[model samples]
Target: MNPFDNILDDEEIQELRKNHNHLRIKFNVLSIFTIIFIFSGMVLFKREKFPTYLEDLLNQPPNRLLHNINQSNRSNYSNVENFQNSLVSNLNGGKGTIQLHSQNDYWRESPLFDALKSGIISIETDCWYLDGQDYELFIGHYKYQLTNYKTLNSLYLGNLNKILDDVNSYNYKNSIEGEEKKGVFNDDPTQTLYLTIDIKNNPELTFKTLQQNLEIFQLKNYLTYYNTTSNEWFKGPITIIISGENIPYDSIKNLTIRNTFIDSPLYEILDISNQSNHSEFELKYSNQLSIFASSSLEKLIDYRSSSLSNYDFVKYGLNDEQIQKLKQYISKAHELGLKVRIWDTSINYDSLYNSLKTNIGINNKGNNNNNIIWNQLKELEVDLLNVDNNVDLLNNDAMIAAIGVSNNNNNNNIKYHDIEDNYNDINSNNSLS
Candidate 1:
């Protein structure tokens, strides 16, 4: 259509057309490539360009898997579930704190009454509305205890809001936090409190009431409910409880339930076994399990005690062959998604400084394998490590030889299940020098 079009020769016109066609093809290809590059850049680089909260998700414990007293999935039972459209934890992992018990064993057929008696601030129970008028929430009997209230009744069964109000109204208490001293003269408040509820059927409406109560109470955060063969009170809180310790689940984030024999595995075994014997013991608490104990190297040092020698780990527990096994244990722990802490059993008996006294080192002679341990700790981002040298931690005899921290839970404190067991359980609560 241009003025030059008619005047141009056929050869020039054809050549121009050919050049335009080639340019057109090149332009199309370049456009496609540019679009793809933009898209790929967004997915590959720009996606992570924003400050993603990867640590907040990764560092926290799982909620559905096994939530403790402080954590409950807000999304799953949210007053505002849809507000946070994210993954599991990010969606529902924030609750303030629910003051409840976590005794590992013994619960009633109807755990509801346990909640009422302040025997347990929170509990898990099965609801069976077998009766036409009511559904019984079974506690210790393994059979539904009939109740007159409907499932929707706030008194018998209700939302978390009411459950919490009830807990506060009842003046339920958390007994243990810090215990610097233990004896017949001292007292232990973190004992298992038990109460029985007989809900005679009428469960349909009553179960609703119970659920309402749970939600009202926000027992999800402070209380843990578990099913049991009978309705009885059991030990609550799997983690350590110290006297005067006010550590709430809301404040403390990094928590762990260590297994027995890692260092003091025998103690755990004994405690669990003893709990099983009691008819009132309830085993349905949180499902998280892993053992935190002294390393084999520390265990060997414990055995040698005053007679420990250099390279004892190689001779007793840490040879090249065994060292590989240690790495395997570490790897397995990681696979299980457990946060591991190194138990410095040897620190309780001797000092790391003493071990390095005679070691041959670098040109400076002061640097050696001990430094390697420190480097490993820094490199591994260890949660805890210990030194036996009391002086190394700045306190000689005043502090418990723990991971150089003043956490109250580190102090030994004993708790009892019944008032009568008070005297017998005192010594078990004593802290070691």
Candidate 2:
């Protein structure tokens, strides 16, 4: 070691030390800037104001869609009637609209995809054909790169012939009159599901494989079919999907769905209402289910003023009595065999949950609009829950989700079941962010 050091030039050694020091200093400075840039991007939108939230947006109605997923003010969606007609009628034409999300939203990374398993009425997941494997389980269409939390595989490959296996399975038992269950991954008819798989691996192979799988169930014109192969969207029997190229990578909804399932490999639309598309077992379980409503019509359907320029949905302020009126629509949707739910009309969190879970009268929560939203949803006895939205969705805290449902709903008394029973597993992650 002494001989080698003597051979090295003094000037060279000095140069080496100076270069090393400079690099170290530069690296430290860069690290600080990188962190700041990342966090700054989180709260700000389009390099401007903070991202809009459902609550704040609910409080403030816009005159028109300030923003949309695809092109702005799409002539295709220039009017509200045109949009509704596209979804409810002319099902053969037009792509379905998906609400993009932001990373800051609490639901962006929770277990929404998995949580959907228990009482899901409708499920939509995009597919990617990148992997050549015979099957995929927990990957999303979006490619993950340069994540702060982890490293991702750095290649893009794809496959063909993705099947919603266990799509139709039979379960038999001896209970109060044993019954057989059907559908992919469900053991009970009362637990059927409408699974929307977005396929995009091998375009040509997707349809053939999906059709082949449909035969496995021998569906009775009720539970079969998917447009998972194509990126077309429709509200009818044949619609497949909307393009993925335009999605805001940071959207809350996108992150939630992405973390939940595997990327699809084909293309085609899946409509749960299409009885011919599924078997009886699937129809019974997934076809008709419940959903909640917001206090105001605008909030209930997410019909922003910009989205529905013709109707001044915001001009008519929502009140306690008016919130109850929303039940009329819920009942109407129910008549079509859908469940009804009400949420987000007010700020009294605890009282609303207690009343709904136990049928007890609310004491702490006042005669506010949220109370009415809770009462309306509970009285309807909705089978599903679209619960409270926490601004800090990244935390995925059950304390936020179960803010009020635990205390009890009836008898002005808190019951044990409210906390112990009728709630989703807290350990499981959520994507409500």
Candidate 3:
């Protein structure tokens, strides 16, 4: 159609072509300069480690990072759910080494199974002993949440027995010299699975029901036991620890051999005035009969201030006041061969919501900010993080870095879970039990 020819004369067209060529040359020069600048920067920083930047990129907050990832890949999150189901299936079949605080919360469609698949070693189950209808014991955080199908036998013990059987079968087929029969966990054969039975109903009745149910696994030697005469402990595949109200030492004092251990009151035990009834028991069996000495984390750490920094005497870390208290509490427990576990530490919103929605109110005694609290606990070297988020705690980059593990779940060494020791002379005179 020659529309440009009709609009412009030959002299004007020549001028247009020259102008276009000049612009093209200028653009090419700018592009070449930009490339040179980038190359120079690489050469200048060649001595520096590039992997450090990559690590920094990966170590973002789990919630924020997961949010951004989900926002960007809406379809990918859907795929992740599908992948999670497959992951659970695979874990049920195979072995994994992840530490978990499966503390009576639902993570996936399957709570306990998902927790085990992810290598959660610690599981907390709240038990309520029913009075009628053949004396059934139920498992739930509240009366409303309890269901006939969700009994401790149905949800926890039955599944646990299956896991033990599977692990034993795997070990028999693939036995290694010097390697004893491992627990459900494949990575660490000596890892002891902690089944914390927190009683919510009549403590004596609930515990009695629990002990009766435990007899199912007792024949298989799947529970830890203490011999009073020999002062020897046979750590089994599963260690049953009891917590909650009415944990009177007088209840189980007469037994020559005990399978279950008690959760000691770290705070109350320090005060001699509160030792009216427990004085003899505390002196005699506090060291041997208890594995974890727990108190409220809020009581330990001051979280009133907005700023979590400032290593002042009143705020964070081992301030003078805290140092005295912790030494009185933690040091005594450690001296008595017990590890410290602080409960009621703040958990994330997702977990909190899940708890509240299910009529299971969180302790909610600590600060809303959990990251700072977690950091402080790690710095204090407190054992057994009483958290609700199984996935976040295990996957959090800051948590992994702070704990000095690339993956916190990979280390399944749980011989450190229970303290192995003989009662020292500190309580030698009070061995009346």
Candidate 4:
């Protein structure tokens, strides 16, 4: 070390050390830049691939994000204005009628509101009147399911009254002098929304309670009623239909004028004209007393047969004989000036048998059975298509195809009958019926 120090000058040694330090600093800076460049390249590659990956992910079934997006796109009306706009735009000029059934667990107020928003024309609610309660009708499928807050007045009638008040008041304020008052729908104000009430217990007491509850609507002139004095039935925004066994026909049948109408038994339509063949209940039904004739689909058609499989029924729909029987029932009801509504058509035999075997009540998840039944019913010209679950009806592709009109279309002049014709045309080549 001493010999090297002597041979080299101090300045030369210092210069050598400075050059080495500069090279070391340059290498460190280059290393950092190389790392940043690699990271940026990775980010760019991911960005390019992400969209396709996301699309693939969305295409997969049961994807929550995709489901949410579809739901929003299907039914995005979150307010009154949006709902009204959607209703007018999607309306098929009263050609087809859809009735929302209150069979699901979520039947309190939200389902009613959702149905209205979806532009459904008819709605059904099951009611029970408590012995101790005063003019209060509770809504639930069973006695054990009833809650104190969910009442016919609070949930349905009160809300309906309020909606009518707002709509009618606004309409009156912008009146055209002597024109008759309009109903809920802006496009077709005269179209009355049917409200079906299925009484669960005590027909007399429940009927009385329902009548008392409807006083507000009656006062507001928002209810459909028949005027015996004028021998005419006046159309209003809402029509109330009562359905149940042991109905107090005596109470309302004799009344000179009344708002509430009865739901006649469809099975007894064949014997209605023949007084000798008519039962006590069948004798009470008339064009004045009832507006809708209804029965379970099974009562009209023999869908349950050991020889035929459930899958075949779901695929092929009603056979020739069944169709004839159904046609006769519908024709008779129509002849009597009563609309026909068939219920218990959404049955999934496979699911039902499985449920029976399992002893666990699970909801039918697939709508193939419902879709097939609805198509046949539509082809048959059922006035009100009773649907148990309408959550995805407005947005379902199959339903839209069945309707033959898009809900998003801006064309306001498309009549429902035209849509029906279009549907018939589309299915003419290969119809389930």
Alpha carbon lDDT of residue 179, candidate 4?
A: 33
Once fitted onto the true fold, the runs of candidate 4 whose alpha carbons sit more than 4 angstroms away are 1-109, 170-180, 272-282, 305-311, 349-371, 402-406, 409-433
Model 4 clashing residue pairs (backbone): 92-416
Q: Which candidate comes out best when scored by TM-score?
A: 4
- Give the local distance difference test score of model 3: 0.56
Off by over 4 Å in 2: 1-124, 128-179, 182-190, 193-303, 306-325, 340-375, 380-383, 387-433
Instruction: Pick the winner on lDDT between candidates 1 and 2.
Output: 1
lDDT winner between candidates 2 and 4: 4
lDDT of each: 0.30, 0.29, 0.56, 0.60
Question: lDDT of model 2 at residue 310?
Answer: 45
Q: How many steric clashes between backbone atoms does each model show?
A: 97, 72, 2, 1
- TM-scores of all models? 0.24, 0.29, 0.60, 0.64
* Candidate that scores best on lDDT: 4
- Ranked candidates, highest TM-score first: 4, 3, 2, 1
Cα error, residue 428 of model 3, in Å, equals 13
lDDT of 2: 0.29
- Candidate 4 lDDT over 89-185, as tens digits, reads 2323332333334333135226455455455667888889898997899888899988776778756786666456444432333434223344555
Order of models, best lDDT first: 4, 3, 1, 2
> Candidate 1, TM-score vs. the true structure?
0.24
Q: Per-residue lDDT tens digits of candidate 2, residues 1-433? A: 4667777588989999999999999999999999999887764542123112221222322222223234333444433333332211121122111111111111223222222222223333444433443333223545451222110111101100011111111112211111222222222222233333444345334433433443323222223221222311112111112123222212212221121122111111122333365553232222111111113224554444454444422222344444454545554444443233233333343544444333333223322232334334445443333343332321222322222232111212221112121112311211010
Candidate 1 residue runs with Cα over 4 Å from true position: 1-238, 241-287, 291-322, 344-349, 354-370, 377-383, 386-433
